[model samples]
Each structure stands twice: as structure tokens, then as C-alpha cells.
Target chain A: METYIFYGIAIIALLVSFQKNRAKTRSALKKAWKSFENILPQLLTMVLLIGTLLVFADTALISKIVGKDSGWLGVLLAALIGSVTMIPPFVAFPTAAMLLRAGAGYMQIGAFVSTLMMVGVVTMPVEIQYFGKKLTFLRNLLAFVFSFAVAWVIQGVVG
Target chain B: MKKGKMILKRYRFALITMAAVGVLLLLQPQIGMKAIQNSTFQLQQMFFVIPPIFLLLGLLDVWVPKTTMVKYMGEGSGIKGILLSFLIGSAAAGPLYGAFPVAAVFMKKGIKFSNLMIFIGAWSTMKIPMFLFEMGSLGVKFALTRLAVDIPGILMIANTLQKMLTAKEVEEIYQKAETLLD
Candidate 1:
């Protein structure tokens, strides 16, 4: 799995760094912990918000909102839902396919998947901590608008 | 008491949400329990996925000189820098939020603004593992079409975002980054 690969690389790198200079390796670990702790507060809030959002926007409700023949309005709804909720791609893609099978249109799925990846309503607090307000706002807004274009293209090609 | 107050100040939002969850549990136990389970799953994923990323980031910070990073991803690195940004971003694992910390480091290292945006765009949508999952689940056409549009879109968005920022603002952001990850 990808997780193993990441851990593998990290551990090997850590060992090499340790062998080269103990002080440098220790500094690296210290830096890593500092960065992690820096974001922990926002991360916890984001996680809790995502959980609550997911509970309200379950599969059935999502499918109902974006079902086939739901039209452009459905695409909008799909994009909004995607923007607000944070689901891992491993879970999201399969759920999207299931939604498709459950009468969700290709355009709707396109918008959902696009915005789901690009826009992070819940993660904005953490994003603000790094990039500040204007950049984060513009990026998410541009991405949200771009999701519609993505939906249109997918509809033309795959729908 | 002062330390406790500082902790509360930092975690005010989380504490509010926890209190909200308590209210939800009282009103609708089933939904509250589901929310708790979902939050636990997310927390587990974060614990599993984040440590290694931070470790690698730390190593990157210590080992990779700023000049080296600037040489590859800095202002004049051009097409090569853009391509490298996309490659690094797409090859990465974990959620979009995970990419932000790495991005902070990249900014601190003096990566070009547009290249940084491209990296973020790639991390958000063009990840190879996610693309493969999309192909399997949604069909090759769906996956390819998204990629086809997304590649160009990423470039356009990055450029546009870079343009939208004033030079002074960009400098300020980079200056903020210099201290942020520390």
C-alpha cells in the first residue's frame, strides 16, 4: 500500500540522516513535531466538522439530490456537497460510482468528484494558517467554478 | 492556570464542536454515535498517514538546502520547474490538507509562486493513485476525461492565481512561510 511506501521511505531516510549526523537528524525530528503540533488544533476541528457533515449528507441523500434528470441544479448541489465534505478518494470514487449506478448523472458525478478534490471548505482554517485568507479564498472559488467546466467536459465526453 | 487557559484558547473551536456533539448525543444518540465513529476513523487515518509525511518533510527541511530547492523550483526554473512540481505533487500520497504543510516548506525554500500553485492543484486532483482508482471505478473514459481537462485547468488556474496576487502580497506570503513551519 502507499502508506507502507511512505513509511519505508521516511524510515530509510531517517536512518541515513542519523548515520550522517545525529544532531541534524534530531533537528529534523524536532522540526517535524513542531509543524505537526502547529496544526493540531485546526486539524482536530476540521476532522470533527467533516464527521458531522458526513453524517448529514449520507449516500441516500446525496444520490437523491444529484440523481439523473436532476439537471444543472443537481450538478450545483453535487458540487456544493463535494465542497463541504471531505472523503478520502479511495472511498469517494467507489461511492461516486455507486451514486452513478443509483441514477446519479455523469455530469453530477463529474461536478461532485471535481469539487470534492479541489475545494476544501472544512480544511480552510488550516489553509488560512499557511496561505492566508485571500489566496485560499481565490483558490477555492476558482476551483468551485472550474468544477462546472469539468462537469460540462465530462458530460460531453463520457455522459 | 495560565497554561490551561492557553490550551483552551488554542482549542476553542474543537471544544465547541465537542460540546455540540454532546448535545447531538443527547438529542439523537444514533446520529451522535455515527459521527463519533466517523471522527474516529478520520483520526486514525490522520495518525497513520501524517507521521511519515512530517518525517520526510523534516528531512527535506534539514537536508535539502534552500539554494537546491530554488535551483529546481525557483523563479527561473521555467517549464522544468512546472513539470517537477506536477510530478512531486501527483506522486504524493494523503489528503489535500497534508499537501499544505509541504507547500509551506516549498514556499520557505523560494519555489516560484505559479509552480507552488501548480503543485497544489496537482496534489488536489491529479494524484496518480487516485486517478487509477477513478479509472477502475468509473471507467477509463471518465478518468481520462477528467485528467485531460484537469491538466490544462491546473495550469490556467495556477497562472491566474499568481497574477491575482500583487508582488508585495506574494513577498509577504513567502515571508510568512519563512516563519510558519518553524
Candidate 2:
């Protein structure tokens, strides 16, 4: 049911993105292609790293580092892990769910999700090339700090 | 020799990154296999879906004039533009990285940098499917709180970053982009 709603929204967005506007859309496409071409190597590398992390990292060790009882230490560790590990938002949720089932806390999960979505340590090289180092660094730093705030807020509200 | 050097330099980062991945895989073969298995279907789906969508997005971006984006989503562009960009981004479903290419295109075409940040932020943070999934697992209130926090947070971050970035830097990027395009 919810999935249907999302699909409906996506279809509408796709349609809207297609409407009349030839010149600007063409320029945007060119830019998109340029960005895509530039980032292709970095993207592939990041994907491989993520795959490797998923395969090799010990979940038990991760859980211990950020598990329910570890408090702020856990949150920090979770955020750090999330910064380096890039997962699609969709995948992050289920992975968080599995972690929660395995005894991770709300704070840990919140930090993980927020950082996973916002901070891009893995993609930093590509991001820096495109946006410049200072701006990219500042944006990522702000996002990382903000993720902790988000986690705390979630903890207060839910717990 | 120069060509070889250029090739080596071009691939240096990729080679290092691959080596890092190989080391990680070697350290945990079982875990690596599980991660690959877990994400295989989704990754395959993404590979299939993204190119076509990006092509269309590219086509639209090129076809649509800058004025349209500005008119719809400019800075201090007011709440309407913000809302529209948010809605558009949220509605465009897929991985957060999927928005990167599109956002880069929008930035090149003179969309306000703040608005592009908002779009990308919302694209990653305010996903519709993920919201529903959260609602199922975590409850409606939990999902709603996340949405509430994310919307304002995205706006604030974008606005703050816009102020921090100088006009000179913006001009430099614009010039560089123009040269690249040419």
C-alpha cells in the first residue's frame, strides 16, 4: 500500500521532469553527463569498498562498538562507521532493522541512518573535486555534527 | 612514457580504492559475500533503472530553461520554491547518490545553490518509500518525527551553506563549468 503511494509519486515526478523546456533541460543533461563521466571511476571504487566492508567487517564487533549499552561512544562509533560506509537509504533502513533486532539501540540506529544519508566520506574525493575541498569539508562536517543532534533528538522523543 | 604516466595518474585513485576493497574482502570473505548477496538485487535494479531515468532527467534539464527552475525554486525564492524543490526531490525515488548527477546538472544551469542543496538533502533524507518502511517497523509517530526534523534541517543547512560560500568561489566554479562545457 505504501509502496504504491511512493511509486505514484515517482511516476508523477518523472512526468514533471519531462515537460516542455528544451534548452535548459539540454544544458542540464550535458552537465549531468559531464558530472557522471567525471565521477564514474570514483563511484565504482566506492561501490567496491562498500561491498568489501559489507563482506569483511565483523557485525559482532560493530554491534559491540555501537550496541545499545555503549551510550555516546556507540553513537559516535555508529556515525563514524556510517560516514565511511555508503548505503542507499533503502538499504540502510533494513540494515538498521537487522541491527536493532540484533540489539542495537534507537540512538545508534538514528545516528547510523542520519550519517549514512548525509555524510559521504567514501565519496569525498569525487565530492571535493566537484564542490571544492573547503565547501565540501564544511558541508560534510556540518552534516556529521547534525546527525548526532538528530540521534539525540530521536532518543529524547522516542525513549 | 608520458602517455603511460598520464594513464597511471588518471587511475591512481581508483587503483588505491580497489586495493583497499580487496584488502577488506580478504579480511572477511564470509561477510563480504553476505553483503554482496544482500544488496545484489537492489544494485542490479539500480543499474537497470538509473541510466534511463538519468537520460530523461538530463533531457528535461537541457530542454527546460533556467528561468523555469529560478521561477520555481530560486533563493529567498520564498517558501513556494522550497516546497516545490522538496516535493520534486522527495517524489523522485531512488538512492541518494542518484540525485547527485541531477543536482550537479541543476547547479550548472543556474539554480540557486541553496535550493540545489535542499533538493539533494531532501532527496536523501525525505524518501517516501523509506518513510513508509519506517512507519511499518518503527510506527507512525517515529516516521513523522523524522520527516518533521528532516524538512527543516535540510532548509537550514542549505541556507547556512549558501551564506558561507563566497561570490568569488561561485564565480570560479561557474567559469570552470563554462570551460568544461565548451
Candidate 3:
């Protein structure tokens, strides 16, 4: 899958780099580990938050929150949840499809999918580490608001 | 002892979050069990993809000179820089979190702030494999519509964010990136 491609390229690069210069390649790996360690604390925090959030906002909860009859309120709720949780698109798109089949409105799903891709409340700490507090908050806030725009467009054109 | 305290300070929020998870377990075993299972699953996914990513990143960091990255994606890289940003972002795989470390490297290597934002925007939204996957799961109409809207949306968002930052704030971020390496 996607995992294999990353490994394949990484291994190939490592071999080639190793062939070129043993010392330089070793330093590269060392620097990689340093940055990974720098981010490790925030990364661990994000994983736990995502776990708890997922349990609370399970697919059933998502369906209930964004039912077909809910209108704009449902779209807002869907966008909010999508912004808050960081589901990978692979699971998210399929879940969205299932929700569509199970009586969720297309507008709601549109908002959900858009925000799910564009925003990440759970990963805010990690983002903050890189971008700082004000910028991180602004970025997510803009992306959150923009999801509604995306939802509105999708609803107008497709739904 | 001082070193331990520094580690603890850095990890305090994560520790508290784990403690909260433990409290949830005590209060509600079933849901908590599911949460732990979910965390482990996520951890497995992380180990699977993250190592190779960091490794490749490490190699890039060592091998690619800053002048080259700057020439291609830096201050005067222009429309070509923007296009390269979008291309790299769209072609990327893995979660959005993966992009941050790579982005940190880009910053360290002196990529323009706007282009870096473009890379981030593209990585978050227009990833090609995920786009194709979206088509299968959500239908061409929905997936294509999102992409069509997102292409413009991503550019606007990236540019706006770039413009919004004060010069000092941007410099501070670049400085932080430099420190992140050591």
C-alpha cells in the first residue's frame, strides 16, 4: 500500500546515500531522529486526543449529528466535527459515502469531507510547535470558515 | 534530575492527556478499551509510515544544499516556485501531520513563506491518490467538485496567510525552524 512506497523510496535512498558517503548519510539519519524527537511530545498528545475524540464522535454519532432533516444546522455540525477530528481521507471518504447512503444530506457530507481534509483541531499542538500559537490558530480558523464556503459550493453544484 | 525535569516539562500536556484517558478507563471501561485499541492502531500506522518519511527527510536534508532549494522555491522562484509547491503537495501521501516536519525542513532550507503555505495547502487538500480515492467513494461529481473549488481555495488561503503574517513573525518562525534541527 502507501506504506510500502514510502519504505521503498527510503531504503533506496539510504542505500544510495550510504554508497556515496557513509559519514554524511549517518548524519542525515541523526538529524532526522533529532527533529522526530523534537516533535514526539506533541505527536503523542495528538494521538491520545484523536483516540478519545474518535470514540466519542464515532460514525453512529456522526450520522445522528448530521441527519438529512437537519438542514444548515446539520451542515454546521458536520463541519465542526470534521474540523475537530483528523480522520485520514481514506476512512473519511468511505464513512462519508456510508453516511450519504444512510440518510445524511449531501450538504452535510460535503461540509464534513471538506473540513476533514482542510482542518485539524487534534493536531493543533503539533502545528503550534512549528507555526506558533497565533498563526496556527489563524490557519485552522480560516480553514474552518472556508469549509463552509466549500460546503456551500458543493451543495449548490452537486447536492 | 534537571534533565528529567526538562523532559517532564516538555511532555506535561501529553502526560495529562494520558491521565485523562486513564480516568476515562476507570469511569467507562468499554469506551476506554475502544480508545486504547484505537490509539494502538494509530501508533502502528505511525511506525509504519513515519520512520521511512523521517529517513528520507534526513537524506534530503544532508544531500540537498540550501542554495539549490532556495533557487527553486525561494524568494525569486516566482510562478515556477508556486507550481512546484502545488505539485509537491499534491503528489504527497500520508497524513497532514507528516507535512509539518517536511515543511520545517523546507523552511530550514529557505523556501519562500508563500510557497511553503502552498505546499501545505496542497498536501492537505489536493493529494492525487486521495483525490482518486475520493472519486471512488464519493462519486466523481462530489470529488471533482471539491477539487475544482479547492484548487482556487488553497491558493487564496496560502497567500492570505502569507500576507497576514508580520515580517518579524515570519522571521521568528524561520529562526525556530533553524533551532529545530539542532
Candidate 4:
């Protein structure tokens, strides 16, 4: 079902892109390739980092930090770690799924995934380069706090 | 020295590739080969999947002119504009970086900074396609809960940031972009 939905959206997007006479599909493709090229180094680094983390970090290690019984301290710690770690959302979801299967709590997964996407401690340098330092810091700080709020809300709703 | 410079320029790509290999080997020689093989395969799959999507996105962006965007999302465009930007951004298919070019174009056309923040925040955090994926993998309740929490969180953060910066400051930034473009 999910695969079907994804393909459907992809098809629709392709059709939309092809609709207009002015659309420069070839140039757009070149630009997209260039974007990928620009990020290749960073992406390679991230893949290695994530691969290392998955290999070394086990359920026991994760549970010690974000186990269900660890309470708000665990939540805060998870949020902090997530804020500092930048993972693509596509990767983060499967990781959270794996952790959940390994006995991590919903709240912890929620906090981590939310912070992973929203907070940018790791990407702060890049973000600051793009958006000024002050704005970047404030955004990351607020996002870190809000990630915890998201976890708390999820706990309330799901628990 | 001129010959050296030419070689350096030509071999830059090879140098980076060799450095990446060296670092991987140095870190964990035992697993490095296996890791590289796996990562390469994964990267190949990602490239095949992601590039076309990004191309489609870029083409859609070009097709939808700046005038159309600004008409709906410009300064004092109000709640309607904010909502429209949010919906468009959340539905748009691509990474957060993809939003930058679109937002830059909108900013050039007088879209408010606060709303751009909202658009970007929601673009990354509140993607509907991502939500559907989550729903299928997780559950509808979980997806809905996340959507509920994230929507307001994105807005509130953007609003707070807006309060921190003055309208004049934002206008100044936009003017700078315009000047640079000119």
C-alpha cells in the first residue's frame, strides 16, 4: 500500500513537471545532479557515521539512555543527542523503528526523531553560514525545547 | 609550478576519493571494505531514486512562476498567504534545501520573512507525504498526533523569531538580496 502511494505521488509529480511548455526538464535534471554533487561529500560522511553508529550502538546502549523507565531525564538526554545528531528523515524513521523493536519507548523515539529533523546542533555551522549565527542558535534552541514538548504530547496522546 | 597546478586541478576529484578511502580504512580496517561496499550500493540506489524526484521538483518550481507565488504569498498576504505557503511547502516533494531556492525567489518578490520561516519549518517538519509513510509504518493515531503537535510548534517558533527581529531588518535583508541580484 505504501509503495503504491509513493509511486502514485511520483507519477503525479512527473506529470506535473511535464505539463508546461516552458518547463526545462533537461536543465532541471542538470541542476538536480549539481545539487547532489555539491552535497556528495557531506552525504558520504553521514552515511559512514550512521553505519558506524548502527554497528556499535546496541539496544542496551540505547536503552540505558532512553528506556521507558528512565523518565524525563532520559527524554531530555535523548532530545539533546538528537538535536546534535543530524539524520535525514527517511533514515531517521527506519532507525526509530529499529530502536522501537529493540525495546525503546515511543516517547524516546518521538523525541529523538522530532529533534533529529527539527534541531540542528550538528548542522549548526552550516546553518549559521546560511542563516546568521544568532538566528541559527535561536532556532535550534527553540526547536530542541519544542521537540521535548512533542515527546510529552505524544506520550499523553499515545500512553 | 604551472604543470603542478594543472595536475592538482585535474586530480582534485581523485585526491578527495582517495582521502575518503584512506579515512575509512584508517578508522576500521577490518570492516572498512564491507562498509564501503554496502554504502556504495545504498548510495547507488539513493541516487537513482532521488535525482529524478529533485528534477521534477525543480521543473515544477520553474513552471510555477514567481508572480503566481507572490500573488498568493507576498507581504501582508496575511493568514491566507501563510496557510497557502504552508500547504504548498508541506505538500511539495523534496528535501529542506529544495525550499531555499523557492523561498529565495519568494523573498525577492516581497514574501515576508516570518512567513518564509513558517514555510521552511513546515516544509521540513510537516510533509504530508512523509506523514502518510509514517501512518503506514506506524499508525494513523501516531501520525495525527505528530501533525497536531508540529503544525502549531512550527508557527509559534516562526512567530517568536519574527518578534525577535524587526520588520525593517528583514526588509533590509531582502533589499540586500535584490541589490546583489541586480
Q: TM-scores of the models, in the given order?
A: 0.65, 0.63, 0.64, 0.69
* Winner on TM-score (1 vs 2): 1
Q: Give one digit per residue, the lDDT tens place, for model 2 in B83-153.
A: 77887676565566567666666666766777777887887778554566565455566667778888878
Greater TM-score among 2 and 4 belongs to 4
Q: Candidates' lDDT values, in order?
A: 0.85, 0.67, 0.81, 0.68
Once fitted onto the true fold, the runs of candidate 4 whose alpha carbons sit more than 4 angstroms away are: A8-56, A129-131, B1-67, B136-139, B179-182
* Superposed model 3: Cα runs more than 4 Å off: A1-64, B1-70
What is the docking quality class of candidate 4? acceptable
Reference contact recovery of candidate 1: 0.79
Error of 4 at B146 (Å): 1.3
Give residue B148's error in model 3 in angstroms.
1.0
Error of 4 at B115 (Å): 1.3
What docking tier does model 1 reach? Answer: acceptable
| Local accuracy of candidate 3 as per-residue lDDT tens digits, A80-139 | 989888666755765576567556778888888988988999999999999899889888
- Classified by CAPRI criteria, candidate 2 counts as acceptable
Ranking by DockQ: 1, 3, 4, 2
Q: Candidate 3 DockQ category? A: acceptable
lDDT tens digits, residue span B1-182, model 4 = 99889656655654665576668779888566755665565556445445444454555455554355667777778999889878777766556656656666677777778788888788778876566556655556777898899989999999998888776766765665565445
